[model samples]
Target: MSALDIFENDSDDTKSAIMRATYHALCEHGYANLTIQRIGDEFAKSKSLLYHHYDSKDELLVDFLEFVLEKFKADIPAEEYDDPCAHLREVLDHVVPPTLDAERYEFTSAMIELRAQAPHDEAYREQFSRNDRFFRQQFADVVRDGVETGAFRDVDPEQAAALLVTTINGSMLERVTTDDAEDAIRATRRELDAYIDSHLLAESGE
Candidate 1:
Protein backbone atom coordinates (compact mmCIF):
# COMPACT_ATOMS: atom_id res chain seq x y z
CA MET A 1 0.00 0.00 0.00
CA SER A 2 1.01 3.60 -0.50
CA ALA A 3 1.93 5.91 2.38
CA LEU A 4 -1.45 7.58 2.32
CA ASP A 5 -3.06 4.27 3.24
CA ILE A 6 -1.75 4.73 6.75
CA PHE A 7 -4.39 7.34 7.43
CA GLU A 8 -7.27 5.12 6.53
CA ASN A 9 -9.96 3.64 8.81
CA ASP A 10 -9.00 5.68 11.82
CA SER A 11 -10.59 4.63 15.10
CA ASP A 12 -11.59 8.07 16.27
CA ASP A 13 -14.70 8.78 14.23
CA THR A 14 -14.83 12.55 14.51
CA LYS A 15 -11.12 13.06 13.91
CA SER A 16 -11.24 10.50 11.16
CA ALA A 17 -14.10 12.25 9.43
CA ILE A 18 -12.40 15.62 9.73
CA MET A 19 -9.03 14.31 8.49
CA ARG A 20 -10.69 12.63 5.52
CA ALA A 21 -12.59 15.80 4.73
CA THR A 22 -9.41 17.84 5.01
CA TYR A 23 -7.59 15.49 2.67
CA HIS A 24 -10.31 15.83 0.07
CA ALA A 25 -10.27 19.60 0.38
CA LEU A 26 -6.49 19.85 0.19
CA CYS A 27 -6.31 17.58 -2.82
CA GLU A 28 -8.99 19.55 -4.63
CA HIS A 29 -8.17 23.13 -3.63
CA GLY A 30 -4.58 23.05 -2.43
CA TYR A 31 -3.31 24.72 0.74
CA ALA A 32 -3.43 28.29 -0.60
CA ASN A 33 -7.04 28.00 -1.66
CA LEU A 34 -8.18 25.66 1.11
CA THR A 35 -10.85 26.75 3.56
CA ILE A 36 -12.91 25.23 6.33
CA GLN A 37 -15.96 25.65 4.12
CA ARG A 38 -14.40 23.56 1.38
CA ILE A 39 -13.48 20.90 3.91
CA GLY A 40 -17.00 21.02 5.34
CA ASP A 41 -18.32 20.54 1.86
CA GLU A 42 -16.63 17.15 1.92
CA PHE A 43 -18.35 16.44 5.22
CA ALA A 44 -21.76 17.25 3.87
CA LYS A 45 -23.69 15.21 6.41
CA SER A 46 -22.48 17.31 9.34
CA LYS A 47 -20.79 20.43 8.11
CA SER A 48 -21.53 22.22 11.33
CA LEU A 49 -19.42 19.67 13.23
CA LEU A 50 -16.33 21.17 11.62
CA TYR A 51 -17.39 24.71 12.49
CA HIS A 52 -18.18 23.69 16.04
CA HIS A 53 -14.74 22.18 16.55
CA TYR A 54 -12.56 24.63 14.62
CA ASP A 55 -13.06 28.39 14.47
CA SER A 56 -10.50 28.80 11.69
CA LYS A 57 -9.06 26.87 8.79
CA ASP A 58 -5.52 27.39 10.01
CA GLU A 59 -6.28 25.81 13.36
CA LEU A 60 -7.99 22.86 11.72
CA LEU A 61 -5.16 22.37 9.26
CA VAL A 62 -2.66 22.37 12.09
CA ASP A 63 -4.61 19.56 13.76
CA PHE A 64 -4.66 17.78 10.44
CA LEU A 65 -0.88 18.07 10.35
CA GLU A 66 -0.57 16.33 13.70
CA PHE A 67 -3.08 13.67 12.75
CA VAL A 68 -1.24 12.90 9.54
CA LEU A 69 2.11 12.68 11.32
CA GLU A 70 0.77 10.32 13.95
CA LYS A 71 -0.70 8.05 11.32
CA PHE A 72 2.57 8.09 9.40
CA LYS A 73 4.50 7.02 12.46
CA ALA A 74 2.01 4.25 13.17
CA ASP A 75 2.25 2.95 9.62
CA ILE A 76 6.00 2.37 9.70
CA PRO A 77 6.78 -1.31 9.85
CA ALA A 78 8.55 -2.45 12.97
CA GLU A 79 9.79 -5.84 11.87
CA GLU A 80 13.52 -6.44 11.83
CA TYR A 81 15.07 -8.20 8.87
CA ASP A 82 18.08 -10.50 8.76
CA ASP A 83 19.95 -7.68 7.11
CA PRO A 84 19.80 -4.27 8.71
CA CYS A 85 20.96 -2.73 5.47
CA ALA A 86 18.13 -4.38 3.57
CA HIS A 87 15.61 -3.06 6.07
CA LEU A 88 17.19 0.36 5.87
CA ARG A 89 16.83 0.22 2.11
CA GLU A 90 13.17 -0.72 2.54
CA VAL A 91 12.68 2.21 4.87
CA LEU A 92 14.17 4.59 2.34
CA ASP A 93 12.14 2.92 -0.37
CA HIS A 94 8.96 3.96 1.36
CA VAL A 95 10.11 7.24 2.89
CA VAL A 96 11.98 8.85 0.01
CA PRO A 97 10.05 7.66 -3.03
CA PRO A 98 8.37 10.55 -4.87
CA THR A 99 4.66 10.09 -5.36
CA LEU A 100 4.32 6.47 -6.40
CA ASP A 101 0.58 7.14 -6.78
CA ALA A 102 -1.87 9.98 -7.30
CA GLU A 103 -2.82 10.25 -3.63
CA ARG A 104 0.81 10.45 -2.54
CA TYR A 105 1.49 13.15 -5.10
CA GLU A 106 -1.52 15.14 -4.01
CA PHE A 107 -0.78 14.72 -0.31
CA THR A 108 2.86 15.67 -0.75
CA SER A 109 1.97 18.66 -2.87
CA ALA A 110 -0.46 19.86 -0.22
CA MET A 111 2.18 19.38 2.46
CA ILE A 112 4.67 21.51 0.56
CA GLU A 113 2.03 24.17 0.24
CA LEU A 114 1.47 24.02 3.99
CA ARG A 115 5.21 24.14 4.63
CA ALA A 116 5.40 27.45 2.81
CA GLN A 117 3.14 28.94 5.46
CA ALA A 118 5.24 27.65 8.36
CA PRO A 119 7.63 30.57 8.21
CA HIS A 120 4.95 33.04 9.27
CA ASP A 121 2.72 30.85 11.43
CA GLU A 122 4.00 29.67 14.77
CA ALA A 123 1.54 26.78 15.04
CA TYR A 124 2.45 25.59 11.59
CA ARG A 125 6.12 26.09 12.32
CA GLU A 126 5.98 24.05 15.53
CA GLN A 127 4.05 21.15 14.01
CA PHE A 128 6.22 20.94 10.92
CA SER A 129 9.35 21.20 13.03
CA ARG A 130 8.21 18.25 15.14
CA ASN A 131 7.50 16.16 12.06
CA ASP A 132 10.87 17.03 10.54
CA ARG A 133 12.73 16.08 13.69
CA PHE A 134 10.78 12.86 14.04
CA PHE A 135 11.60 11.59 10.58
CA ARG A 136 15.20 12.76 10.74
CA GLN A 137 15.65 10.79 13.90
CA GLN A 138 14.03 7.77 12.32
CA PHE A 139 16.47 8.00 9.40
CA ALA A 140 19.42 8.47 11.74
CA ASP A 141 18.33 5.49 13.81
CA VAL A 142 18.31 3.30 10.74
CA VAL A 143 21.80 4.40 9.78
CA ARG A 144 23.10 3.88 13.29
CA ASP A 145 21.51 0.43 13.39
CA GLY A 146 23.15 -0.48 10.10
CA VAL A 147 26.59 0.56 11.35
CA GLU A 148 26.15 -1.20 14.65
CA THR A 149 25.01 -4.44 13.06
CA GLY A 150 27.89 -4.52 10.52
CA ALA A 151 25.60 -3.94 7.59
CA PHE A 152 27.13 -0.59 6.74
CA ARG A 153 30.41 1.26 6.97
CA ASP A 154 31.02 3.68 9.79
CA VAL A 155 29.34 6.98 8.96
CA ASP A 156 27.91 9.93 10.74
CA PRO A 157 24.29 8.87 11.13
CA GLU A 158 22.91 12.34 11.63
CA GLN A 159 24.69 13.73 8.57
CA ALA A 160 23.58 10.82 6.46
CA ALA A 161 20.04 11.25 7.73
CA ALA A 162 20.07 14.97 6.99
CA LEU A 163 21.39 14.32 3.51
CA LEU A 164 18.63 11.82 2.83
CA VAL A 165 15.93 14.11 4.19
CA THR A 166 17.22 17.07 2.19
CA THR A 167 17.47 15.04 -1.00
CA ILE A 168 13.91 13.72 -0.61
CA ASN A 169 12.50 17.17 0.20
CA GLY A 170 14.28 18.81 -2.72
CA SER A 171 13.14 16.10 -5.09
CA MET A 172 9.54 16.34 -3.86
CA LEU A 173 9.57 20.13 -4.17
CA GLU A 174 10.91 19.79 -7.70
CA ARG A 175 8.43 17.05 -8.49
CA VAL A 176 5.37 19.12 -7.54
CA THR A 177 6.64 22.14 -9.48
CA THR A 178 7.54 20.62 -12.85
CA ASP A 179 5.69 18.77 -15.60
CA ASP A 180 8.44 16.13 -15.97
CA ALA A 181 8.01 15.12 -12.36
CA GLU A 182 8.35 11.36 -12.92
CA ASP A 183 11.68 11.80 -14.65
CA ALA A 184 12.93 14.00 -11.84
CA ILE A 185 11.75 11.54 -9.22
CA ARG A 186 13.45 8.59 -10.94
CA ALA A 187 16.68 10.55 -11.21
CA THR A 188 16.47 11.40 -7.52
CA ARG A 189 16.06 7.72 -6.52
CA ARG A 190 19.06 6.78 -8.64
CA GLU A 191 21.19 9.52 -7.11
CA LEU A 192 20.13 8.57 -3.61
CA ASP A 193 21.03 4.94 -4.29
CA ALA A 194 24.42 5.97 -5.61
CA TYR A 195 25.06 8.13 -2.60
CA ILE A 196 24.13 5.31 -0.23
CA ASP A 197 26.48 2.96 -2.05
CA SER A 198 29.38 5.37 -2.02
CA HIS A 199 29.06 6.71 1.50
CA LEU A 200 27.06 4.30 3.66
CA LEU A 201 27.45 0.75 2.43
CA ALA A 202 30.50 -1.34 3.03
CA GLU A 203 32.27 -2.14 -0.25
CA SER A 204 32.47 -5.89 0.40
CA GLY A 205 28.74 -6.22 0.84
CA GLU A 206 27.54 -4.77 -2.42
Candidate 2:
Protein backbone atom coordinates (compact mmCIF):
# COMPACT_ATOMS: atom_id res chain seq x y z
CA MET A 1 0.00 0.00 0.00
CA SER A 2 1.19 3.49 -0.77
CA ALA A 3 1.19 6.34 1.73
CA LEU A 4 -2.38 7.39 0.90
CA ASP A 5 -3.70 3.82 0.87
CA ILE A 6 -5.05 4.24 4.37
CA PHE A 7 -7.35 7.09 3.29
CA GLU A 8 -7.90 5.64 -0.18
CA ASN A 9 -11.40 4.21 -0.43
CA ASP A 10 -14.76 4.82 -2.09
CA SER A 11 -16.47 5.16 1.30
CA ASP A 12 -14.00 7.88 2.26
CA ASP A 13 -14.75 9.68 -0.98
CA THR A 14 -18.50 9.64 -0.35
CA LYS A 15 -18.05 10.87 3.18
CA SER A 16 -15.77 13.59 1.91
CA ALA A 17 -18.39 14.56 -0.63
CA ILE A 18 -21.00 14.83 2.09
CA MET A 19 -18.68 16.98 4.18
CA ARG A 20 -17.80 19.27 1.27
CA ALA A 21 -21.47 19.86 0.55
CA THR A 22 -22.00 20.62 4.19
CA TYR A 23 -19.05 23.03 4.23
CA HIS A 24 -20.32 24.97 1.23
CA ALA A 25 -23.70 25.19 2.92
CA LEU A 26 -22.07 26.45 6.08
CA CYS A 27 -20.14 29.10 4.16
CA GLU A 28 -23.01 30.31 2.03
CA HIS A 29 -25.75 30.16 4.63
CA GLY A 30 -24.13 30.33 8.06
CA TYR A 31 -24.48 27.60 10.69
CA ALA A 32 -28.09 28.43 11.61
CA ASN A 33 -29.16 27.71 8.04
CA LEU A 34 -27.16 24.50 7.83
CA THR A 35 -29.88 21.91 7.91
CA ILE A 36 -29.95 18.37 6.57
CA GLN A 37 -32.10 19.57 3.69
CA ARG A 38 -29.59 22.23 2.69
CA ILE A 39 -26.63 19.86 2.44
CA GLY A 40 -28.74 17.28 0.65
CA ASP A 41 -29.80 19.94 -1.82
CA GLU A 42 -26.23 21.13 -2.26
CA PHE A 43 -25.07 17.66 -3.23
CA ALA A 44 -28.20 16.77 -5.22
CA LYS A 45 -28.75 13.92 -2.82
CA SER A 46 -31.56 12.80 -0.53
CA LYS A 47 -31.78 13.82 3.15
CA SER A 48 -31.70 10.16 4.10
CA LEU A 49 -28.48 9.71 2.19
CA LEU A 50 -26.87 12.67 3.93
CA TYR A 51 -28.20 11.52 7.29
CA HIS A 52 -26.60 8.13 6.70
CA HIS A 53 -23.20 9.83 6.87
CA TYR A 54 -23.95 12.38 9.58
CA ASP A 55 -26.42 11.74 12.40
CA SER A 56 -27.30 15.28 13.48
CA LYS A 57 -26.58 18.93 12.76
CA ASP A 58 -24.10 19.00 15.63
CA GLU A 59 -22.35 15.92 14.29
CA LEU A 60 -22.09 17.60 10.93
CA LEU A 61 -20.71 20.74 12.54
CA VAL A 62 -18.05 18.72 14.34
CA ASP A 63 -17.12 16.97 11.12
CA PHE A 64 -17.07 20.22 9.20
CA LEU A 65 -14.73 21.95 11.68
CA GLU A 66 -12.62 18.83 11.87
CA PHE A 67 -12.38 18.89 8.11
CA VAL A 68 -11.28 22.52 8.18
CA LEU A 69 -8.72 21.73 10.90
CA GLU A 70 -7.29 18.90 8.83
CA LYS A 71 -7.04 21.18 5.82
CA PHE A 72 -5.35 23.83 7.96
CA LYS A 73 -2.74 21.31 9.03
CA ALA A 74 -2.10 20.42 5.41
CA ASP A 75 -1.92 24.04 4.26
CA ILE A 76 0.61 25.04 6.92
CA PRO A 77 3.98 24.13 5.42
CA ALA A 78 6.63 22.70 7.71
CA GLU A 79 9.31 25.25 8.43
CA GLU A 80 11.95 22.52 7.83
CA TYR A 81 14.45 23.85 10.30
CA ASP A 82 16.04 22.27 13.38
CA ASP A 83 16.17 25.52 15.30
CA PRO A 84 12.89 26.17 17.09
CA CYS A 85 13.08 29.91 16.70
CA ALA A 86 13.82 29.76 13.00
CA HIS A 87 11.12 27.17 12.36
CA LEU A 88 8.66 29.29 14.33
CA ARG A 89 9.67 32.28 12.23
CA GLU A 90 8.78 30.20 9.20
CA VAL A 91 5.33 29.52 10.66
CA LEU A 92 5.07 33.18 11.60
CA ASP A 93 5.21 33.75 7.86
CA HIS A 94 1.66 32.40 7.63
CA VAL A 95 0.04 32.62 11.08
CA VAL A 96 0.30 36.35 11.93
CA PRO A 97 -1.50 37.17 8.81
CA PRO A 98 -1.95 40.24 6.82
CA THR A 99 -1.02 37.84 3.99
CA LEU A 100 -3.94 35.42 4.27
CA ASP A 101 -6.01 34.21 1.36
CA ALA A 102 -9.79 34.09 1.06
CA GLU A 103 -9.75 30.48 2.20
CA ARG A 104 -8.10 31.46 5.48
CA TYR A 105 -10.57 34.29 5.94
CA GLU A 106 -13.49 31.90 5.46
CA PHE A 107 -11.99 29.43 7.88
CA THR A 108 -11.55 32.17 10.46
CA SER A 109 -15.16 33.24 10.13
CA ALA A 110 -16.34 29.66 10.52
CA MET A 111 -14.22 29.33 13.65
CA ILE A 112 -15.66 32.50 15.13
CA GLU A 113 -19.17 31.33 14.40
CA LEU A 114 -18.43 28.01 16.01
CA ARG A 115 -16.99 29.72 19.06
CA ALA A 116 -19.97 32.01 19.41
CA GLN A 117 -22.32 29.04 19.43
CA ALA A 118 -20.21 26.99 21.81
CA PRO A 119 -22.12 28.03 24.91
CA HIS A 120 -25.46 26.88 23.57
CA ASP A 121 -24.01 23.65 22.22
CA GLU A 122 -21.89 21.77 24.70
CA ALA A 123 -20.80 19.04 22.28
CA TYR A 124 -19.52 21.52 19.74
CA ARG A 125 -17.48 23.35 22.36
CA GLU A 126 -15.90 20.11 23.55
CA GLN A 127 -15.17 18.77 20.08
CA PHE A 128 -13.91 22.10 18.83
CA SER A 129 -11.67 22.56 21.85
CA ARG A 130 -10.31 19.02 21.50
CA ASN A 131 -9.54 19.54 17.83
CA ASP A 132 -7.90 22.87 18.64
CA ARG A 133 -5.71 21.27 21.29
CA PHE A 134 -4.62 18.61 18.83
CA PHE A 135 -3.69 21.31 16.35
CA ARG A 136 -1.67 23.23 18.92
CA GLN A 137 0.19 20.08 19.92
CA GLN A 138 1.64 20.02 16.41
CA PHE A 139 3.56 23.24 17.15
CA ALA A 140 4.52 22.28 20.69
CA ASP A 141 6.30 19.19 19.43
CA VAL A 142 8.52 21.28 17.19
CA VAL A 143 9.23 23.87 19.88
CA ARG A 144 10.08 21.26 22.49
CA ASP A 145 12.43 19.42 20.17
CA GLY A 146 14.11 22.63 19.18
CA VAL A 147 14.61 23.65 22.81
CA GLU A 148 16.14 20.29 23.75
CA THR A 149 18.74 20.82 21.07
CA GLY A 150 21.02 23.85 20.96
CA ALA A 151 19.00 25.20 18.08
CA PHE A 152 16.51 27.04 20.27
CA ARG A 153 17.29 29.17 23.27
CA ASP A 154 16.34 27.66 26.60
CA VAL A 155 12.93 28.89 27.75
CA ASP A 156 9.30 27.91 28.32
CA PRO A 157 8.38 26.07 25.16
CA GLU A 158 4.77 25.75 26.28
CA GLN A 159 4.31 29.50 26.70
CA ALA A 160 6.16 30.18 23.47
CA ALA A 161 3.93 27.73 21.68
CA ALA A 162 0.79 29.27 23.19
CA LEU A 163 1.92 32.74 22.18
CA LEU A 164 2.20 31.67 18.58
CA VAL A 165 -1.26 30.10 18.47
CA THR A 166 -2.99 32.92 20.39
CA THR A 167 -1.49 35.61 18.19
CA ILE A 168 -2.88 33.96 15.05
CA ASN A 169 -6.29 33.61 16.70
CA GLY A 170 -6.25 37.21 17.93
CA SER A 171 -5.06 38.55 14.57
CA MET A 172 -8.02 36.90 12.84
CA LEU A 173 -10.34 38.63 15.29
CA GLU A 174 -8.59 41.92 14.58
CA ARG A 175 -8.80 41.34 10.82
CA VAL A 176 -12.58 41.43 10.51
CA THR A 177 -13.17 44.86 12.05
CA THR A 178 -9.99 46.60 10.93
CA ASP A 179 -9.92 48.59 7.68
CA ASP A 180 -6.43 47.39 6.68
CA ALA A 181 -5.68 43.94 8.09
CA GLU A 182 -2.40 43.62 6.27
CA ASP A 183 -0.89 46.75 7.76
CA ALA A 184 -2.08 45.87 11.28
CA ILE A 185 -0.83 42.31 10.96
CA ARG A 186 2.58 43.50 9.77
CA ALA A 187 2.91 45.64 12.86
CA THR A 188 1.67 42.74 15.00
CA ARG A 189 4.24 40.42 13.45
CA ARG A 190 7.13 42.69 14.37
CA GLU A 191 5.90 42.94 17.93
CA LEU A 192 5.51 39.17 18.18
CA ASP A 193 9.12 38.61 17.08
CA ALA A 194 10.35 40.99 19.72
CA TYR A 195 8.15 39.32 22.35
CA ILE A 196 9.65 35.95 21.46
CA ASP A 197 13.16 37.29 21.71
CA SER A 198 12.52 38.71 25.16
CA HIS A 199 11.01 35.52 26.52
CA LEU A 200 12.89 32.73 24.73
CA LEU A 201 16.32 33.92 23.65
CA ALA A 202 19.12 32.90 25.98
CA GLU A 203 21.61 35.38 27.34
CA SER A 204 24.78 33.30 26.92
CA GLY A 205 23.68 30.74 24.40
CA GLU A 206 23.29 30.27 20.65
Candidate 3:
Protein backbone atom coordinates (compact mmCIF):
# COMPACT_ATOMS: atom_id res chain seq x y z
CA MET A 1 0.00 0.00 0.00
CA SER A 2 1.45 3.34 -1.11
CA ALA A 3 1.44 6.35 1.22
CA LEU A 4 -0.65 8.25 -1.30
CA ASP A 5 -3.03 5.33 -1.51
CA ILE A 6 -3.93 6.36 2.02
CA PHE A 7 -5.34 9.52 0.43
CA GLU A 8 -7.37 7.40 -2.01
CA ASN A 9 -5.84 9.18 -5.03
CA ASP A 10 -3.38 7.53 -7.41
CA SER A 11 -1.98 10.64 -9.10
CA ASP A 12 -1.65 12.44 -5.79
CA ASP A 13 0.05 9.39 -4.36
CA THR A 14 2.68 9.37 -7.08
CA LYS A 15 3.35 13.09 -6.71
CA SER A 16 3.50 12.74 -2.94
CA ALA A 17 5.94 9.84 -3.23
CA ILE A 18 8.14 11.92 -5.48
CA MET A 19 8.04 14.79 -2.99
CA ARG A 20 8.83 12.51 -0.08
CA ALA A 21 11.84 11.17 -1.95
CA THR A 22 12.93 14.71 -2.75
CA TYR A 23 12.66 15.74 0.90
CA HIS A 24 14.70 12.76 1.98
CA ALA A 25 17.33 13.55 -0.62
CA LEU A 26 17.37 17.19 0.42
CA CYS A 27 17.81 16.40 4.07
CA GLU A 28 20.49 13.84 3.33
CA HIS A 29 22.30 16.02 0.80
CA GLY A 30 22.31 19.76 1.25
CA TYR A 31 20.98 21.85 -1.63
CA ALA A 32 24.55 22.31 -2.87
CA ASN A 33 25.01 18.57 -3.39
CA LEU A 34 21.50 17.26 -4.05
CA THR A 35 20.95 15.23 -7.24
CA ILE A 36 18.13 13.28 -8.86
CA GLN A 37 20.11 10.08 -8.29
CA ARG A 38 20.25 10.83 -4.57
CA ILE A 39 16.52 11.43 -4.43
CA GLY A 40 15.90 8.12 -6.22
CA ASP A 41 17.64 6.38 -3.36
CA GLU A 42 14.81 7.51 -1.14
CA PHE A 43 12.05 6.85 -3.64
CA ALA A 44 10.04 3.64 -3.43
CA LYS A 45 10.09 3.21 -7.20
CA SER A 46 12.79 3.21 -9.87
CA LYS A 47 14.88 6.29 -10.63
CA SER A 48 13.61 6.17 -14.20
CA LEU A 49 10.11 6.97 -12.86
CA LEU A 50 11.43 10.24 -11.39
CA TYR A 51 13.29 11.11 -14.59
CA HIS A 52 10.12 10.41 -16.53
CA HIS A 53 8.32 13.00 -14.46
CA TYR A 54 11.11 15.59 -14.10
CA ASP A 55 13.87 16.35 -16.59
CA SER A 56 16.22 17.80 -13.97
CA LYS A 57 16.92 18.01 -10.26
CA ASP A 58 16.18 21.74 -10.13
CA GLU A 59 12.74 21.25 -11.63
CA LEU A 60 11.93 18.48 -9.18
CA LEU A 61 13.29 20.43 -6.21
CA VAL A 62 11.20 23.49 -7.05
CA ASP A 63 8.05 21.40 -7.24
CA PHE A 64 9.07 19.67 -4.03
CA LEU A 65 9.43 23.07 -2.36
CA GLU A 66 5.95 24.04 -3.46
CA PHE A 67 4.58 20.80 -2.04
CA VAL A 68 6.32 21.34 1.28
CA LEU A 69 5.13 24.96 1.55
CA GLU A 70 1.55 23.97 0.81
CA LYS A 71 1.73 21.30 3.51
CA PHE A 72 3.15 23.82 5.97
CA LYS A 73 0.32 26.22 5.28
CA ALA A 74 -2.28 23.51 5.65
CA ASP A 75 -0.80 22.34 8.96
CA ILE A 76 -1.35 25.68 10.71
CA PRO A 77 -3.82 25.29 13.55
CA ALA A 78 -6.74 27.16 12.08
CA GLU A 79 -9.39 26.73 14.80
CA GLU A 80 -7.82 24.60 17.48
CA TYR A 81 -7.00 27.36 19.99
CA ASP A 82 -9.76 28.71 22.20
CA ASP A 83 -8.87 32.37 21.63
CA PRO A 84 -6.99 34.48 19.15
CA CYS A 85 -4.18 35.18 21.61
CA ALA A 86 -3.65 31.47 22.14
CA HIS A 87 -3.90 30.93 18.41
CA LEU A 88 -1.29 33.58 17.73
CA ARG A 89 1.02 32.08 20.32
CA GLU A 90 0.62 28.68 18.74
CA VAL A 91 1.50 30.13 15.37
CA LEU A 92 4.70 31.65 16.73
CA ASP A 93 5.62 28.43 18.47
CA HIS A 94 5.03 26.55 15.26
CA VAL A 95 7.52 28.73 13.41
CA VAL A 96 10.32 28.28 15.93
CA PRO A 97 11.62 24.75 16.44
CA PRO A 98 10.56 23.75 19.96
CA THR A 99 12.90 20.80 20.36
CA LEU A 100 16.43 19.85 19.38
CA ASP A 101 15.39 16.75 17.49
CA ALA A 102 17.99 15.71 14.94
CA GLU A 103 15.46 15.10 12.18
CA ARG A 104 13.81 18.46 12.66
CA TYR A 105 17.17 20.19 12.67
CA GLU A 106 18.23 18.50 9.44
CA PHE A 107 14.95 19.36 7.74
CA THR A 108 15.08 22.97 8.89
CA SER A 109 18.71 23.29 7.85
CA ALA A 110 17.88 21.99 4.38
CA MET A 111 15.00 24.48 4.10
CA ILE A 112 17.22 27.38 5.10
CA GLU A 113 19.78 26.30 2.51
CA LEU A 114 17.06 26.27 -0.12
CA ARG A 115 15.79 29.67 1.03
CA ALA A 116 19.29 31.10 0.62
CA GLN A 117 19.03 30.31 -3.07
CA ALA A 118 16.02 32.61 -3.49
CA PRO A 119 18.26 35.51 -4.51
CA HIS A 120 19.71 33.69 -7.52
CA ASP A 121 16.78 31.53 -8.63
CA GLU A 122 13.58 33.07 -9.88
CA ALA A 123 11.39 30.05 -9.11
CA TYR A 124 12.74 29.84 -5.58
CA ARG A 125 12.39 33.59 -5.15
CA GLU A 126 8.74 33.53 -6.21
CA GLN A 127 7.88 30.58 -3.96
CA PHE A 128 9.62 32.10 -0.95
CA SER A 129 7.91 35.45 -1.61
CA ARG A 130 4.56 33.70 -1.55
CA ASN A 131 5.48 31.84 1.65
CA ASP A 132 6.57 35.05 3.36
CA ARG A 133 3.48 36.97 2.33
CA PHE A 134 1.19 34.15 3.45
CA PHE A 135 2.64 34.03 6.95
CA ARG A 136 2.69 37.81 7.25
CA GLN A 137 -0.95 37.95 6.34
CA GLN A 138 -1.74 35.09 8.68
CA PHE A 139 -0.04 36.77 11.61
CA ALA A 140 -1.77 40.06 10.84
CA ASP A 141 -5.13 38.37 10.60
CA VAL A 142 -4.70 36.69 13.96
CA VAL A 143 -3.68 39.95 15.59
CA ARG A 144 -6.63 41.71 14.04
CA ASP A 145 -8.90 39.00 15.34
CA GLY A 146 -7.53 39.35 18.86
CA VAL A 147 -7.94 43.13 18.89
CA GLU A 148 -11.45 43.01 17.45
CA THR A 149 -12.42 40.37 20.00
CA GLY A 150 -10.96 42.44 22.86
CA ALA A 151 -8.48 39.71 23.77
CA PHE A 152 -5.55 41.93 22.82
CA ARG A 153 -4.84 45.62 22.86
CA ASP A 154 -5.31 47.68 19.71
CA VAL A 155 -1.99 47.72 17.83
CA ASP A 156 -0.72 47.89 14.29
CA PRO A 157 -1.23 44.33 13.18
CA GLU A 158 1.21 44.57 10.30
CA GLN A 159 4.06 45.86 12.40
CA ALA A 160 3.46 43.31 15.14
CA ALA A 161 3.25 40.58 12.55
CA ALA A 162 6.52 41.63 10.99
CA LEU A 163 8.27 41.58 14.35
CA LEU A 164 7.07 38.08 15.10
CA VAL A 165 8.07 36.64 11.73
CA THR A 166 11.42 38.41 11.63
CA THR A 167 12.29 37.21 15.11
CA ILE A 168 11.45 33.65 14.13
CA ASN A 169 13.64 33.87 11.04
CA GLY A 170 16.48 35.34 13.06
CA SER A 171 16.24 32.50 15.54
CA MET A 172 16.38 29.96 12.73
CA LEU A 173 19.54 31.55 11.36
CA GLU A 174 21.12 31.58 14.80
CA ARG A 175 20.25 27.93 15.26
CA VAL A 176 22.20 27.04 12.13
CA THR A 177 25.44 28.43 13.57
CA THR A 178 25.26 26.80 17.01
CA ASP A 179 25.56 23.25 18.27
CA ASP A 180 23.27 23.92 21.21
CA ALA A 181 20.29 26.05 20.19
CA GLU A 182 18.10 25.42 23.22
CA ASP A 183 19.30 28.51 25.04
CA ALA A 184 18.71 30.79 22.10
CA ILE A 185 15.30 29.30 21.39
CA ARG A 186 14.28 29.74 25.04
CA ALA A 187 15.46 33.36 25.10
CA THR A 188 13.44 34.08 21.98
CA ARG A 189 10.33 32.50 23.49
CA ARG A 190 10.75 34.55 26.63
CA GLU A 191 11.08 37.75 24.64
CA LEU A 192 8.05 36.87 22.57
CA ASP A 193 6.05 36.23 25.71
CA ALA A 194 7.08 39.60 27.11
CA TYR A 195 6.19 41.26 23.83
CA ILE A 196 2.75 39.71 23.92
CA ASP A 197 2.17 40.81 27.48
CA SER A 198 3.35 44.37 27.04
CA HIS A 199 2.10 45.12 23.54
CA LEU A 200 -0.84 42.89 22.86
CA LEU A 201 -2.53 41.96 26.11
CA ALA A 202 -3.89 44.36 28.68
CA GLU A 203 -2.34 44.58 32.14
CA SER A 204 -3.86 42.09 34.53
CA GLY A 205 -1.64 42.26 37.61
CA GLU A 206 -3.80 42.73 40.67
> lDDT of all the models against the reference?
0.82, 0.68, 0.76
Off by over 4 Å in 1: 1-3
Residue-level lDDT tens digits of model 3 in 1-206: 11122223324477888888787678678888998989999888877899999988878878977776677665554564558777877666766755646656777788788888889999988887887787788889888887887778888899988898788778877787686677878888888988898889855651
Output candidate 2 Cα RMSD.
4.9
lDDT of 1 by residue, 122-179 (tens): 9999998898888789888888988987778999999988887787678778878889
* Full candidate order by lDDT, most accurate first: 1, 3, 2
lDDT of 2 by residue, 122-145 (tens): 878887787658647867887778
Residue 9 in model 3: shift from native, Å? 13
What would you estimate as the lDDT of candidate 2? Answer: 0.68
Candidate 3 global TM-score: 0.87
Q: Regarding lDDT, does 1 or 3 come out ahead?
A: 1
Ranking by TM-score: 1, 3, 2
Residue 38 Cα positional deviation in candidate 3, in Å, after optimal superposition = 0.7
- How do all models score by TM-score? 0.91, 0.77, 0.87
Return the top candidate by TM-score.
Answer: 1
Q: Which stretches of candidate 2 lie over 4 Å from their true place?
A: 1-12, 44-47, 70-80, 202-206
Looking at model 3, residue 56 earns an lDDT score of 81
